[model samples]
Target: MDIIKKRRSVREYLDKPVEDEKIEQIVEAARLAPSSCNSQCWRFVVTKGDIKEQIIKKGLGGIVLANRWAKSAPAIIVACADLNFLTHKVGAGIKGIEYHLLDIGIAVEHLILRATELGLGTCWIGWFNEREVRKILKIPRSIKIVALITLGYPKGELELHEKQRLDLKKILFWNKYGNCEG
Candidate 1:
């Protein structure tokens, strides 16, 4: 719960290098995440140096808001999945696309939680030009890029701000839709 509460979309970061061992631990946590049919089609590309810079530039073309902050992070993890492997197994037909995406989401959340536990920060970046990213990373056409996560130590304390959300009465129903009162 403490880690959950501390997990925030940190945009700013300190100019400090994250240890490789810590990075490995975070990836290990993600690796242990549940997958659809235990297929585990997810692939992680950890980026740094010129390659990371190129990814940040090409990737941010679609996202106008977090481009600047994304460039500042020390490292970026490009999450990709083999489409065929995820949907088909041992000559099987398409199982479900939703399952693949859900599996990736679960893995990403595990990464975020592990980052928080390690006193690090992370921001899940989804708004990117997939084609550009594919080209930048030299990923094969058969693979699908799911998300890009920026990781680093936070620059400062994050202030809790009010977030808009649906009320319990509006969102929850006793047994059917629209049955609860405000």
Candidate 2:
């Protein structure tokens, strides 16, 4: 199986810390991710130690209880997009498409996949108070927070079961929606 297929969204993590070199690899994957029109507007804020704790306990605000499991993770990577890029401005103006968010999403997937390949656990977090996170990270208001990914080692024996997904026949159509053979 491909590493991408093996990747799972892990919530529980061991208290062990991720090595700096591994972190570098994960960030490098994000850096190399393809961006729409090569906008490369994604920005990542890596939180460790005390800052990591603060992000979980405070930055997440009332949603903390829902994602409390991630608080134990040794590192939390916050993904953001710098909307100041010319492609973002032009695309949004001309086509009403937000390419920066797409770029950030692709970059985050790369980071998470790299972490998983390196034997690290990761959980992608999107529900939270963006304002609070931006304030805590000291990010400028012009930037848009995209997502958060927590990283660490697995807490126990890891196993992979068959993933539940829609059948290809049910989701795929030859030419358009409802065009599949009946």
Best by lDDT: 2
Clashes of each: 0, 0
Candidate 2 segments exceeding 4 Å error:
157-160
Compared with the true structure, the alpha-carbon lDDT of candidate 1 equals: 0.81
Model 2 deviation from native, Cα RMSD in Å: 1.6
Q: What residue pairs clash in candidate 2, if any at all?
A: none
What is the lDDT of every predicted structure here? 0.81, 0.85
Worst 10 residues of 2 by lDDT: 154-163
Please give the range of 10 consecutive residues that has the lowest summed lDDT in model 1. Answer: 86-95
